[model samples]
Target: MNSRFTGRLHLPGEDGYEQARIGRVFNARRPGRRPAAVLEAVCEQDVVEGVRLAAERGWQVAVRSGGHSWAAWSVRDEALLIDLAGLHELSYDPETEIVTATPSVKGGDELNPYLGRFGRFFNGGHCPSVGIGGFLLQGGQGWNARGWGWAAENITAIDVVTADGELVRADADTNSDLFWAARGAGPGFFGIVTRFHLRTRPLPKHLAHTVHAYPLDLFDEVMTWLHGIHHTVSDLVEIVAVTQTPPGEREAVLLVTGVSMTDTPEQAAQALAPLHANPYADRALFRIEAQPTTLAEQLHNQRTANPEGHRYLVDNAWLTGTAQDVVPAMRKAFTDHPTPQTFTIWFSMAPLRELPDMAFSMQSEIYSATYVVYGDESKDAEYRAWLDEAMADLQPVTAGQYLGDSDFTNRQLRFMGDEQWARLRAIRAERDPKGLFAGYLTADEPPTNTNHWER
Candidate 1:
């Protein structure tokens, strides 16, 4: 070990090795895979040291902040993990309505309180425990994403440590290419982001939610109706459907949830009027109550449903057609899921205001995925096969997998289009020529670039 490395470093069987390996990943399939050493960084200089050490030792580097990579990409065997758990600092400027956060401390649970004091909040994902580093970097899809757009759009600047162990600020005007590429590449990115500067919004005056539970027999009609309902509702209304077996029930049930962001209950009711008018309203098991709730409450509920320790194998895609076009395959997938814990989600979103020039190019009215959850390692192969088959069947009706959920090992298509990927690759090569970072770029022979970094 190098004395110049100022932060703590742990090897296998060491005191902190088990703790360093502890993360949000519940997937049990890759349990024994371990990092060569875990570098627990306390400061930006320590990150620079870790990168420099990896370069000197000819070892690849895996970076982790909140440690919620669906595929557990943060803990690769034989690689050095730069764990940023100690760097959780957050600050907000009320006058400017801008929030600044360190990589590890930017999860919704960590930042919501700070923002709440000023009646300001940023768009984060449904899960409160998701670290902002990976979430916002991969084009964060959050509460009312259609209304606010991808959470990445709210980011004004970032402080990043490049492959050369030099700190640089990236934004529209400075280090512009790195700024663009950083917005959506997820684990495929080339640099380690230390801090994020994001613009925040005034908290919604009122938040309301409603749920409709329908029988499985109505899957086709209900799904088709759910897909088209987005077009009729206000962008402030976000709707989702999850199909799973409720406790004590022998059959699967479809729970359609809706969130309306408005100033009053009356406005929320108006926004959700279309859903209330469903012809199958009679068929759905009756439960209709729209009540106000806080952002913290909503996020907390999402986190509780998906607690730590449960393994998750996720597969998702951007919809290419109406729900009517793809409901049969979805019905089959959900009906035969291995366990009651397994479920599918449908996020019917509004159109983006404008496409940002980043690697997260794919978009559709609906984003869909299945999360297979189980504690047993014995069924790992079965769940993996089920998810793979489901995703394969939906490929024709999907644009591509979301970058955050994408498994780089069996990558079929990318989250970005071909041109966006080419641009991202060029910038990655130019910035990190040595491939010190661990990800898809380093996993394969990296793309060649005539333009080289000024080392």
Candidate 2:
């Protein structure tokens, strides 16, 4: 009903309010807080105006670009939700090797459509429906993270709407600090990002994978062998292990899936050859499957398996030591899953690029997580507690936490390390002097420096 806003706004009990209130992964229906209003911004101007309105009325504003936060931080109680779903748009410059898009743009639905045409692709999240905004901001762990780096490092520039309702550009040569902060700021960002300019890469000619399954009895042996062979594997490959019950199975099984990015089938096979060379492979193997596929095909299966509607309890930790060091915890995480649908993932990430100085500093050798998925509300508390206990057991081997999968309220310096945390707080205080966008991520209080710091 606000004429000044360039987009449609829905208040509580409004006709479209329920539909607009949904977050990507978290169904906002249960224990719903009911935001003060949801503003579906149609363009950058709409976002600019909406921010000004929220500030004028002294209302807390929560920016929602992807709506996929496992914790559902975007739709908070009594806050004004700036929904960017209506702002979906994408553009690419061949000569510049850069792709620019509105915050609401998704990797599978919006990006791949155009990227496939140009024979170019950006390293984005594995999920098709994930929005580019939060994915990149939270240090995107894309398909081949080892070969490329965090998706945030590929971001060349960002157009941010600051707390003062002014649009500004943050990049390397200009507003450097803001650029550095925005790349890995997660949900703690002090401004609303309207657009992202990212550097693109040539799409690999072939994407293929080989999978192996082993019974829980072989978990330790298989895990030790896999970790021991890490150095022999190529950066073009990724090996992930999960524990879940297969179709027609009553017991949980440990499945190892390995993917490779290469120019040809032969190259892909060669890159993954080390996996099959394990001397003890035959003793632990239960099944094997291999295939060559496109990114779209892979994402399709992922979406089908983990569809929207299910309740999820997600948490992750970065392993400081090798997989062998965390074998006991990993075994327990998978074997004792709360439900048949629940899964625990171990990501073998070997960085090929020099780590950048950013807020996303949890760059350990391997990343481990438990994804507890179910539909029954009655079992929510039970599943959450299980995940908490699993993570607690893993704490000894963990170097830090991943902000994207972490509980914002409980996040500590371990996620970004103490130095980065201090710097983030200082910048947050200077930029958001009024603490306008506080508690969107970690609840750490910003510094008291109201004085604007110069670059």
Candidate 3:
């Protein structure tokens, strides 16, 4: 095993073993689950050999790309952890307008910067540091997802190492079952995806934004208005409403923001005009209307909102219902936060686009997620309880949950449609009958793929 791997391997109690295990994890709150051994694979062959080696030793395989899973799903007990941090392959084809990137590639920080050179862009995760592997697998809700659709929709192909230790390419035609599952299987995928072939769009020439900040006291009134009219806004604009304490501010404020992707200032202004006509603009603490912005500036703001090295507990729901029902149910999540850095977002996917036939068949017109960020280790339970209460408030209107922000060990919600979930299980049964892959880190024997309350 040592001879085949160009990268280093860390065994239990070995020097640097602990660092190799969780060094790349984004959340400060580490899990107690530990792998039997950690293999830091450097190349494609290393991944292949590592899987073969795991099979020979009868160890289940767990893969990590970018290590940014909020739940730290990569670290599993008695598994061979194949860390894909060293796989940094990236290239772009001018003719096809497709960018091929390794799974570990950071979507915002690395892939976008590289694509920007070619005047192209692939909508990736909002957090600059999130790796495309987990993000894309869980149905990436990237920037302008409301417009461009889920990031997985842009995936043209993926090179995967199957549970049987064969490296194969999965796309719309060949190995299509794997292709269908890869887009939305999340941590339950049966193979290690080495590379992603993604379709890219011509980078927008101008970026303009509109931001309206309202006092938290008006959360209901302001949110009700937004829910009623967001779908009427142009598709080129990404809209979101969030409540968080801004830098240098002691109290949290509700910020309704719209970012328009257009070629020229005139186009941007026109696309963002509807948002500027906000009824409560006069009551706003501040307003930035149709102001020019850059992707660099937008990414910087995302970094600020989701800072590193803090213990993060996140939960989300695909929401459905009228403003009258949804707005009131969201009051606790939007207004009462446990910490200053904690935030809850109301993302608009109104007039939701139809999803392609894939395993990720669950969504609603509204997406709500609460990120509880804090530093005190002793307060994990306290903060968790608070987050549970906040999310409970939304259950009256909650449809399901997105896997990206979910921790199934704490709570499990339906992440896929009933039919898609059944199809995914059949594929998993066929591809990995022996269960070589460490699937879905949950507290139960098998994840029910149903909202707990409904059960």
Candidate 4:
């Protein structure tokens, strides 16, 4: 920013810089050194300028589109922030059954309707607010995952801004290494992603959407039942457990979502009717909606309530095995420090993977559940600390972290395995040897700081 460059530089003192740097969750502590200059990248050309300038000045690089990366790695102090909000453009081809969506194209909403109109759909996250560049690259776990596959498996192509800031397309046929790594490698290891072209499949009408709430007293029982049901359900089921501990209390929502890929909602209900038999005595709150709509609507109701005004600090982890006793342990942690924040937990798993030959980071597959914790900013740090301690307590009892949700824990890194971890490290070194592109991916951290530093 202090240096004279061809690109637009909004210094820390600039008027627009502060507002532009605002993250998805306000007051949600923004870490890392603040960037001295911010590049409002309006187009591919702007991205090139920003990359070029950053490299020339030897500045750290960071990329931001939706600021949805749980780590908020998009922003940094004294580094160069390359904002991608200006590149919100989407192109859908019905004939090819593909959607080329920008980093800013809230992937679910932007392309779902088009895909629906085309009678097609893509594997995406539970939340409709998630963007393509981050979600797909981070490894998407969708509600439809019961049948299709992980969100990453469906990606067809990507347009990325490499370390030097050149716009390149990566896919099965191009930039093969980068393409394979980006499937679930996340943002920090490489450069910025401008857009993505994803494969789509035919979508069916009259899908069943359901939500069932169980009592905390029956948490263990519910988890026990869930374990047995997972192995029995039809592939048309997308289930997520919403577990929360609000300072001094414990509550849970055992959501059972069934998406009928075939006709006859009545038949789908009959198929899933066995689950309804277990009565939870007033602790049960259920919604079995059989409607003719797109996955976008189904997710919108699940992820975001009010898009215009809402602050959310989201955290993640992967839970495997059964969550029976882990629930009680989590309840204990919540009791230790109670707050009014609405903390939440998101659970997901990759059903029998299809890409046996593909080298997805080994850690990506182990987790049977992905926990996405969201809450108000007031109790942000406290809740986060509690979640970690609680998760650690459950480590001996539950599954490990989900790459999509877990932090940079050294112990967790081992989950990636020595060979796999070496491959990722080698990839980072080979692609960005100078580590110039490291800033944006983890721009919220200090220089020389490793992820999950405390751990």
List per-candidate RMSD values in Å.
4.4, 4.3, 0.7, 4.6
Q: Which stretches of candidate 1 lie over 4 Å from their true place?
A: 22-31, 247-250, 441-455
What value of lDDT does candidate 2 attain over all alpha carbons?
Answer: 0.77
Top-scoring candidate (TM-score): 3
| Candidate 2 residue runs with Cα over 4 Å from true position | 23-31, 284-290, 322-324, 351-353, 409-413, 441-455
Q: Clash number for model 1?
A: 2
Model 4: per-residue Cα lDDT over 1-455, one tens digit each = 43444345687777877766764422244554577578877777788778888888888887777666655666665568888777778777877878888777775666676567777777666666666666776666665564667677877878887886788998888887778778766654487787788888777655665556555556666655665555455666655555443235444444544455555677667655645655552466545444444555666565533233343433344444444544454454323324333434433343554553233544321233323234455765665666566556545544334455544421232223345446666777888888887532321343222224234
| Whole-model lDDT values for every prediction | 0.78, 0.77, 0.94, 0.59
In candidate 3, which residue ranges exceed 4 Å CA deviation?
A: none
Clashing pairs in 2: 24-67
Give candidate 4 misplaced runs (Cα > 4 Å): 1-8, 23-32, 244-261, 277-297, 303-314, 322-343, 346-351, 356-359, 362-378, 407-417, 439-455
TM-score of each: 0.93, 0.93, 0.99, 0.82
Which of the two candidates, 1 or 4, achieves a greater lDDT against the reference?
Answer: 1
lDDT of 3 by residue, 1-455 (tens): 57889998899899988998899999999998889899999999999999999999999999999999999999999999999999889999999999999999998899999999999999999989999999999999999999899999999999999999999999999999999999999999999999999999999999999999999998988999899899999999999999999999999999999999999999988988888887888999999989999999999999999898899999999999999999999999999999999999999997799999988889999999999999999999999999999989999999999999999999889999999999999999999999999999988757999999999
Worst 10 residues of 2 by lDDT: 446-455
Candidate 3, position 174, lDDT: 98
Top-lDDT candidate index: 3
lDDT of 3: 0.94
Per-model tally of clashing residue pairs: 2, 1, 0, 18
